[model samples]
Target: MYIRERRRFVAMSLAAITLGACAETSVRPRQLAGADPARGRDAAERVVCAACHEIPGIAWPRGRMGGSLAGFGGRPLIAGRLPNQPDILVRWVRDAPSLIPGTGMPPQDLSPAEARDVAAFLYTLE
Candidate 1:
């Protein structure tokens, strides 16, 4: 247990350092053209997204339930089923349950634009 805690602390520290470097820069979103990454970063916090997913930029969550999105940009699939492409990613971000019935996530209630922006921010993670 002590080792686990120590590892967690180290990993969290590394994540903070890595994300701090990219705090001001915006990666061009591949999923949706013209999607604003900065807005996406803010929207993720506004929506309390880290409640489910371990997002890279914001460090508070460290969610235990959902998977970490540390390298979402390079991932090959969305839910281990759908291909991680632009249109599909945008839709998945907005409504995971719509794509996969009985999915654990509830309706995210994000607008189309907000979803696009959130998706953009997710894709920025290296």
Candidate 2:
């Protein structure tokens, strides 16, 4: 009976360890260490973030145009609705124009991965 109990305990422990290992096997997001502004600019281009909003390095409208997202990270609220968290930012990037009416910013239509990358890039600013 003692031997059976020990075997069961060992099996459960092994299973728990295997599950923990699996949980850690996902692609870790890049650390939030200050990213290269230039690379972020490139990422903005790839995601076409400048199509609506004026990004840092992308060639944007010369005159009075869309709202300047220069200090977007510092903003207290997104469109005065959602708080600026990574998940919230991803959601906003994925669907903003729909989320808010009369918002000049149109949805850039990014995938989950693309949105996450953009969020990481944006967090680098200040």
Which number leads on TM-score?
Answer: 1
- RMSD (CA, Å), candidate 2 to true, equals 10.7
Tens-digit lDDT track for model 2 on 25-111?
232432434434455556668766665566665675432355657766665556667556666676677777666766766677566
Query: What lDDT does each candidate get?
Result: 0.78, 0.63
Every model: Cα RMSD to truth: 15.0, 10.7
Error of 2 at 24 (Å): 24
| Steric collisions counted per model | 0, 0
Error of 2 at 53 (Å): 2.0
User: Highest lDDT among the candidates is held by which one?
Assistant: 1
